[model samples]
Target chain A: MKVAFPYFGYDTIALKNFLEMLGAEVVLPPLPTERTLSLGTKYSPELICLPFKITLGNFIEALEAGADTLFMAAGARKCRFGYYHFIQETILKQIDNNVDFYPISQYTPFEFIFQKMPKIFSVSPARVMKSINFLLAHSRLIENFRKLVRQARVIDFTLASIHEKHALEIIADAINLMQIRKARKEIKALFNFADDLPENIIKVGLVGEIYLMLEPFANHDIEKELGKMGVLVLNNRSLYRHIKHLLHIDFDRIKLNHRAYKYLKESPGGEALNTVGEARTFIKNGVDGIIHIFPFTCMPENIALEALQKMSDDYSVPILSLSIDEHTSKIGLLTRLEAFIDILKRVKNQKAVSRVPRSSLLTPH
Target chain B: MIKIGIPRALFYFRYGEFWQHFFRNLGYEIVVSPSTNKQILEQGLKYVSSEICLPVKIICGHIEVLKNQVDAIFLPRFVELNHGLYTCPKMIGIVDIAQIQVGNACEILSPKIKDNFMLAHFQTGLKLTGNPIKVIKALNRAIPYLSHHKKLSNSEDHKQRILLLSHFYNLWDDFIGKDIINSFQSCGFDIATKEDLPDKVLKSDKGFAKNIRWVYERELYNAFQYYSDKVAGICNIISFGCGPDSLIGEIMSKQANEYKTPFLQLIIDEHTSKTGINTRIEAFSEIINRNYQSKPYLTK
Candidate 1:
């Protein structure tokens, strides 16, 4: 069967690979664009969230490309996402009854475990075990990719300070081949050629929804852009942390992923806590600024933004809150990011300059 | 020595003075949080999850502002303040959620005030402090006084008929900002809110759309059913970024204007810039006044 998986974030790619490993022909939808937003706007209900419409648009596009089955993630959380499966399916079926829908939510210990297990593990215990193994292997691969990309970001910033000419090309190459393990190693070797920084670069913290922070396509490579501007980027989201969190076995110090535990303690996914806790950490760490990016109408992120806003004020840190809908354009977003970086850099420099003696401002009189 | 904290939002706009007066008469100290501000909004956001409507956010923010300062914050868990009339589910959950989130730092005086069943318990507490006879007499006097107050407020002429077409604040009393209602009354417009409408709107089918049966939308439907023709014009006050209000307000505005009635869409926030709200209201009132003066409808 030709299955279509609608893109949510960088994690979607990993999921696609995992599905493909099961011998299913997986068709991935293209990255969200204006056409996608337009399609969503035209078909979806006016009051539903922006993500719902975008995903619906993606499903339609994927269907047009000859994919028959639709895959959507389902989670039992306080957010309306629990009902998303039913609502989206109803809406999609209303549009076209032929599209087959499946929700990938078997990982949780819920009421569905007993009922759905027979269907999921129907082939054999061995087959199910193999599928599970495939998921674990692909998850590790994705985690490795995340670490490499983060390393590439650090290298890009360092290279920008020394050799601005080759910085963009090097970073772009690293980013394009981020998913490939061999390419990540080669990119690490290229970074050795970069000259040492004159001084420690200003560090800015990135916080918000997992998808917006982790995925390049969602936020338009915001962290990468910040690195290119010679600013160090700190991102606290990855598939490894998420999987570790879902294990419900906190084997580390304090026995929990503090970010996931605090926010998700109330909700199953721990989505909100990651943003709020990260904001608190970033402020304490003396980061220059914090950025909160989430898809528009995301409830958990909105709550997190509110908490982060207060945290920012209490700690005397500035926060840039950006809501990315399907309508977010690449050029416009980058230009805004450039302006934000310019303003933040100027402010940081002025603060540093002010700390110097007034006599330095004068003629050493 | 009970420091009762009343959030200056929702019901504060309508019953604030009454509650303040009643509590003071009963010898309870009051420490109201300052009128809604960014700090309150921030605090609300801190305590509440994002799925809650903006009004709930505003209320939680108010509670957060008074978290440590009060002996107990009064959040009356009202199902039916009057017989047959009811509150939204969000409002019913406020006291429980507030208790859970705020915890030992703040005491939640959860009075099930729907039928005023706690009146005897409240009197018993008062009796512990003084003469039982005096407490009985006080209750005797207060019962009628409270009922008269409710009757007077519920009466059409004294009550400003404001069709409060907004999102549900879990603490309905805190969302409407009784102070704003008082300000409106002080400004000579009787404040009538959605809660004052009949229960028929809750049952009436929109038949137009199956998905339109949401709680807040039903309240809007109730507002339209009760006061679209009776009132001068519907002042559709909504908070910015509220999802349902954007559509409902627009639809109601069109419906109002189509009926040749004046309607105003006032977007409220934590900012106390009453200038914009007042100006919009004034413009709307002026148009209503003009329409009234030009018509034969006022002849009676």
Candidate 2:
């Protein structure tokens, strides 16, 4: 099968592995842009969050590019996102196009295959168990790969403090080249470089949907701009987190990410839980402030913003809510970002910041 | 006397007269925000932190405009009116969110409706008014007052019918003329609406009443149920960027599948086009005259 993965708001690293492992030629969605938004606008309901539109656009474009088997993970949360898979299915079917959808939701089809391991593998239960044991043993491969990625982040966050554009780019490229090795010599070099960063660097936290947090274009290169201003932007999210939350549904995950699949199932406002959790994490980590980005009409973010006011007031960690739509102007966004950075800078210089004791913030219900 | 501020949004547009009359009958002063305008919208946007939908933004704007002018603001936290039919989560959460977001320090009224009680929970009214008799009296007067208005609305001779399906603004306001009904009448059409129906009658209808409190669906059912044979064409007006309307609008449009009557689904926004709206109305009116009235009503 020619598999297509949604380029939601981040780089498709794990999706590439999944598709390639499944013995399929993978095609990613077109890079998000004004054009991508327009394509989604043509078919999707105008009221849906921008991410839905972008995802719809990606699915359509991928299908047009002769890819089959569109993969979408269904979430159950207070966020309307959980409903996107169903909505997209109806829309795609209504378009009368023959595209196969492989939605990986709460009850994945893979469950059946995994459950009937011996039958599918045509081996004895003992042999299947042995193979499962082997896979579990080397599940270390995924973990090792994950740690290498984390190390890259530490190196990247450190280099971002240098405020040298070209040098940072070189560091990023080098870090990317570092292979996932248990005893990799490069990991130590990167760690040493990170430990040498200046003590005065201000750290700003970015909390939002995985897509918006990672996708520079969607958020107008916000993290980079913050980094350019000498702010160490800590993004506490990842594809691994997305997949991990998806594979093992947790109720508490909703409290962390109101947009998490499980919470979206229970209701629509739970995604805000994740937003609150992210802001709290940033506050706890001594980050200066948090920026929450969501597409216009994002229910989870709206709910999160409600909780954030109390969180921000109690934590004394200023939070800026940034919502993007097709009509969002880069100039306006930049101006707001500049203002927030100035606020963060002022607080850092004053050193008089009275971080609200954590107990004062809104406790998750 | 503690004055209450009622925002001229959402249910207020539809039930303003009943609400005002009800409260007035109880001898309490009512302060309503002026019609939605640029200044009002800006005032709300200023107070409301970013990242909410326009309606919520508009509500915030109303609150900003009315904040300090009243002792408390009424944000009807409508959970469900009829069984299983629910209000949008935005409506349910808006009161709590608004209280937190603005930190206005003003009192808010959230009428919790549950356990098959029809009135806005007499306890909530008692809390607001501080007298059980007054609450009961006010609620009693409001109920019949609403029924009377419904009768008047139903009996209206909508000569030049403009089946406005727009959001609260297009339905309630006569930017076309101050009174949408009068404006439609002047244009030679009778203005029929979902609110014009007697709730008792709808409840009596086993099928229609079953989905009665599903507000949007109820409106749609009312449109089809009462005025299907009378109106020229049903203009399904919806606001742009409304989430509830997404599914509700689709369901409504699909309801038009069998009704050979002229059905026009018009989407409204902050920036409305009078010319486009007029043209659509004209076309729909022409179609309704040609196709409707000649056919018999068929329930699907």
Give the TM-scores of the predictions, in the order they appear: 0.60, 0.69
Residues A161-193, candidate 2, lDDT per residue (tens digit)? 442333223322331112323323443443444
- Candidate 2, residues B1-300, lDDT tens digits: the string is 878788876667656777787778777789998887767767766654454546666777778877789888877666555554555556656765667644655887766654344466467677666888987887777776554432224334334454555455346543322333443444466666665555654444365234234455555555565665565667776656556566456545555665555677776554556666667666666776666456434211
Across B1-300, the per-residue lDDT of candidate 1 in tens digits comes to 878888775555545555565566567788887876667788887676555566767778888888799888876665454333334334555554566567689777766655564473364336334655555554544554332212115334543344445433421433344444544555566555665555565445554222342444555766675576666556666664555554456556656767876677766655547566666666666676677667645321
In candidate 2, residue B119 scores what lDDT? 60
Best by TM-score: 2
